[model samples]
Target chain A: MSVSITVGAYGVAFGAAAVANGFTVVQACLLSLLTFSGASQFAVVGVIGAGGSAISAIATASLLGVRNALYGVIMAPHLKVKGLKRVVAAQITIDESTGVALGQEPRGIDAMRKGFWYTGIGVFVFWNLFTLAGALGAQAMGDVRAFGLDSAVPAAFLGLIWPRLTGNFERALAVGCALFAIAMTPILPAGLPIIATAFIAIAVGLKR
Target chain B: MTVQIMTTLWIATLGTSLIAFLLKYSGHSVPERWLSHPKVQRINALIPIALLSALVAVQSFSEKSQLVIDQRVVGLSVAIVALLLKAPFPIVVLSAAISSAAVYNWL
Candidate 1:
């Protein structure tokens, strides 16, 4: 319950940030409703907010969403759903749900299933609610930049990625990627520099 | 002109959502071994880190086609401090916003 709420409540930041980037409240809500993945949704708004092209936004968001595909692979057999239910299951096969389900592995498959459903549904409900609240709140604020909400974009990204920098190698690679992106900012278009960093990762992976 | 921009944004928004859903659904439908290749998994694991780190940099320091060092830097610095202190997500983000706003107002 705590995990779901905590993760879901971050939707407030997303909603506000989306509006700060010029998305209408409905658009912001729709992103959360349809995309549902935090990082991918953020990439969409962030890229477009920076005046990137639609292709760039879609490319960046799809890249961030690759992990969900992996998560679905992990959960499919265990979930055992089909047809419409399979679609629903795919929608909610996110980081929190997958982690919670896996954490319950010691208890048995039944417990794991329950954990997955409860966390997924729990997060979904709270996320949409908080997103609505946040969009409305940000809309009321008028000048979001005056509140330094622009700064919130990078800060939010930092918060999301912080947990994943678990090892020295990962941390170093992140710093390198950040520097590389900064260096390429002047040369590349709005969103291309960030996408370019994927090559660095692929190179490292292949080398290893 | 405004309609054109709005139309573009709407297309991007819906298109991104569709791609995201399809990616997730494909995982369940596709054979596991296709994705479970050791090289594939290894590269996939590193992709988010690279992309997100670059995103943080790009968002924080770039404007249009130029690199910048501005109040957002001050804000991001404070955010790093808050994270180092093990602050909660909201607090980390809020502190960054507040401090950056303060800088923007006073300076």
Candidate 2:
């Protein structure tokens, strides 16, 4: 499932996007290699390309980053680190792993540990390798839109999100978010549109 | 850009990894009492969806080059068609890819 998640979600779309921009294969690969954050990367790229100052890009990226902050603090006690190990542990705190790890029965287990690291590391490795490959391969990948690779991303998104639909509220929120995002893409700064749309989705959908 | 390319990538990767490890190290500290907290549940509801929406929408729609609206649109529509028909995932994706590639190359 992690592989499935990684391939469609991270590998194809983000990798492709990284390459589509002017990022060198090495740079793209390395970026994905270390920074496991997704939205922030997108935000950073969008901000930079929009003629935004470095501070704006960083600020937008960092603002989008606060979510992981909560993950860090919440997962703090479970980590049980007292030394250098604490530093290593702190690095991988992300939305996906945190969500999965936190949902588990035990606070800490070899299984949870493996799952957390493998999913993050595995996705990271694949994402970077493919991102570079995709970047270098962009000429080869030529005209992905025709093949509807464009649609694959949003469609793949549907796969991850659709399953979580538990009620009218969730469904409504998602639809609202999607529509809002589409409407706002040309207007808002890179990160602002989607965030605004999603929260709007939450607020509006939950209203009923 | 290169600096950001270097800094943002390194910082994000290392940061995420370290945070993940620390969280993993912490393991499970969710207070049983907090398990059913209304606030926690509400926050959880909006957080991922919000994040996921941002991530997916930005990556898909934001483009660097000319936004072509031909077979790419055709391919996408067909994919939506495939979804409506409940065809297999790979088939839909591959078929769409092939169609769009053909569109770009020939027309």
Top-DockQ candidate index? 1
Model 2, docking class = acceptable
Q: Name the DockQ score for candidate 2.
A: 0.25
What would you estimate as the lDDT of candidate 1?
0.88
Each prediction's TM-score versus the true structure: 0.97, 0.64
Candidate 2, A1-208: lDDT as tens digits: 6455455444455555554444445555555555556655555444444333445455545544555555655666555665665555555666666766766637556666666666656555565665665556543666545445555544444444544666776766666665566566676654456456545644653553
Candidate 1, what DockQ? 0.81
lDDT by residue for model 1 over B14-104, one digit each (tens)?
9999999999999889999888888988888888899889988888898888877888998999999999999989889999999998888
Off by over 4 Å in 1: none
Residue range B1-107, candidate 2, lDDT tens digits: 66866565444434443443333343333343543455544655564455455444444455532222455455555666776676655555556566666776687
Reference-based lDDT, residue A177, model 2: 68
